[model samples]
Target: MCSGADEKGGEQVAGRAGGMAALPAGLAAAPGNAAEARARYFNSANAFNIHLDPVPAHIFTAPAAAALGPEGAVTGYFLCDQSARLGCPWPATTPFMLARYARIAPGARLAADFAASGSIWYVIAGKGRVYGAGAGAGAGAGAGAGAGAGAGAGAGAGAGAGADAGVAEESALAWSRGDVFYLPAGASMLHADGPDAAVLWLVTDEPLLAYHGLRSARPDDAAVHFKAGDIAAEIERIHRSVPDAGTSGLAVVFSSEAMQARRNLMPALTLSLNTLPPGCAQSPHRHNSAALTLIVAGADCHSRVDGETCAWSDWATLVTPAGAPHSHHNEGPRRADFLIVQDGGLYYEARTMGFEFLGG
Candidate 1:
């Protein structure tokens, strides 16, 4: 369960679960569907270097979808879809996972929604009040909260002094830009947008349900209210505590207090922030899970996925297929940051979160 050492002299060593990952033998035989197993994992024998081929994959960056409700007031952007011919095995056999960007109309609230997949939401802009009432396996994310299966009520559960002050089995927190939260599947959520509308990117694990023919549970809704307030403040904390924490710029992780967070590999998924110092490269590393990264800050950053390289601007998104060797480099003078949402926890709980690190 050991994770690769961080450049910060292990200060950033992330805990690991499960054991090393390996392709199972006879997965094509009894008790296993080779296709389903393949959809969940990649062959380690294949080279991990993946590239975006000239530009960042555009198929995932389509413009936001508008008119999300009967009121025709809500706007949303779905970053990743099941239609892309990106050689991804997801959304077909497992959950149809996708990252989303959305703009809620001012003063309007999304109708109540519930799905069987956990969701993660980050308040990238504007302010709004969120409310959701649920117990057991949910809480703290837009309109609803819970601990979920593998984890318990998280998101707002734990906070350092002045970090997120309070979080419980209630989703009645006022949120602004920078607050990130989690929503467990099956938890009902409803949100009223601020007077100025709210912009956010959401990540979810719904494809699995769809793959299983549970299409009726999916619906459009919102994400979180535990505002982080200042991105710089969190970045500053990382720099002060571990200057040169290896891998280009600095990075930080967002996690919940309960043993089971609805939005992690344990229950489903999780989020992290990666900041590359201007014009630096992060160490090359690969894990057993795929990642969906949203460009949150800086610009003109190119990611090298195995042999393919793709460039994207601020607010764009990139993907790293499970087990694909990938790395990021800041192509501009300003610091570049990204929000990394991944399903690594799935491998973690299954004891197969194997990973390897190459020098930066």
Candidate 2:
């Protein structure tokens, strides 16, 4: 829930640990049916780029609390009910979810028992540890921890880290500044502590539950490991032959080209990393895929979607659904870097079903 606005000016609730509270007055409810609601939510201009302010602390209960370690950490989420909200017409069949993670120093913790259809972790700042599922483990094995002297390591067994004595021998994936980690369907993860640790986790609904189900079935199995250097190497390899897409200016084909390799890690999705030269304007364009853009560098860019304009800065997260007309112009004097993630399969499915795009 990163926003362009300050924390105090935006809406604030009791926070995540408060449990399921009613939607604020005038805040719309999810539609009676998912399909109709998704269509309305995705179609509404207001629904585009809805950003939630960050919650300051972690919220976990007794049963759910078992997943967290002894450290003082926060694990809350920003949920978008596609079936109820009116904005970008989200595909009725697709699912989505987004959440933020935070942890303090001196201790490592397991702060979440959740999963997603498509999950990504964006390191806003600071360092931390991440643990995923073993090759075999049931989701229910050691899912929670009780409040006690040894609660910190109580539920550290089964699929993810803390399982099996060999778990100690198992290393946790470490992340630093400007790093992004992608979790495949059914994978489990845990985060350790670092100096001033914090993270933004975005995920989809269906895949999350599926991964949990797999973990519940096989708790002692091992999982694959990756590092930030590994991701950087892949990016470098992809750009080795296609230097044009790496240019610092307005480029249309930049995204399409980067997808050439990114699609391998995420075969179900399409991704592009773009750089905007100072004072350049990106002509408005529309496509048939649900899209999300994260500002990696620079500042002062104006984004227009369906005639509504908004200012964007570094670390800002924006969303634009299928067939929605939008464009961006860099108003800053410095270059701007942005990352785009889209539903690749959905676009193919729509094209196969006869939905066509007329503008670029």
Candidate 3:
């Protein structure tokens, strides 16, 4: 008999009389037993098994419209959140990632002070400048005072500001439409929109950190910027160099000097610019990491995710659940381009990526 079960005699008598239909509750959880009242028990058949709600493969169009629409006056963010379906307390687009669209009004500044290990940003429309204080710059940098002191004084400079902004420009990255950049954790950035309003798509690992009850520490690397023209050139180079039959897709992965070894954008995330030529489709495949993709440029394009067709809309964000068979298709005469961010870095580090192609 367990210490808390004073009524074990009755249970014993019942057990001796006939077989019980169900397993009994923990003996320590008896009505009057205070010492082990909190104890809970489960058998081998059910102890390690759990069934939580699955992350839905969905498209986020409304949030994209709110940010890219020309009517908004105030600066704000529209989150592609599915936390309710995911059974998570914090906002999330996927179980491990959170995605959002940021609209910055003309001359306004957006302070990015997220509690995330890292963030990736794509300039959807308009022009602007981003001033990122290196890791551990503290509150002053985030508030647009100390760190931005070197990043020119105002947002009106736009693209012209990059050439003449002087040494102070080194601390800032001037961006226009189609540019992309990454910011490290434990740091903050002040996004100052130029003369016109700007829309940006951003994704971060905040949900992963929240799940582990951990905060990001000082990052070792600084921010890295990717010019739209440079990225396009690289993709063109890949297209010219690799034979169509030799590759899975015409894609280019974004990486920095420090992260070259792992070929990822951050410790937990990977960013790639994928393209599909006219009237072509990618091979169906699956991986362990879920993908959050931004439709950069495509018409008459769609993705087949686990047999469900997800159509592409301009500036829309799409969610691809982990381990789902998926492929991209372009039925139009023009080429299609998309930017994908995934939790593949974590999977690669854990040696559980489990990537494979599914034959049609």
Best-fitting candidate, scored by lDDT:
3
Off by over 4 Å in 2: 1-75, 78-84, 87-108, 112-115, 134-166, 187-189, 205-264, 349-360
**lDDT of model 2 at position 20:** 21
> Please, what is the whole-model Cα lDDT of each candidate in the order they appear?
0.55, 0.44, 0.77
**TM, every model:** 0.63, 0.54, 0.82
Per-residue CA lDDT of candidate 3, range 73-131, in tens? 55666789999999998888998899888777776666565668778999988887666
TM-score of model number 3: 0.82
- Candidate 2 achieves a global lDDT of 0.44
Query: Per-residue error at 211 for model 3, in Å?
Result: 0.3
In model 1, the runs with Cα more than 4 Å from the true position are 1-59, 64-79, 84-96, 112-114, 133-171, 187-192, 212-225, 230-232, 243-249, 260-266
Q: Please write out the lDDT profile of model 2 over residues 36-145, one tens digit for every residue.
A: 55552232223444574321111112322222234444333323223223232332112332322233233344434433333455555556655444322333233233
For residues 1-360, write the lDDT of model 1, one tens digit per residue: 224555665642333322223333334334366566664344433335445322123324553323122343433333345433544434321133566555555654432233445567777667765444331223434333322212211122210122112434343556677777665444433344555656667776655454465633323323332457455687788877756434444666666554234444225566778888887887788887778887777677788887688776556667777777788888788888788887776777788877778665
Ranking by lDDT: 3, 1, 2
Which predicted model would earn the best TM-score? 3
For model 3, the stretches where C-alpha displacement exceeds 4 angstroms are: 1-41, 135-169, 244-246
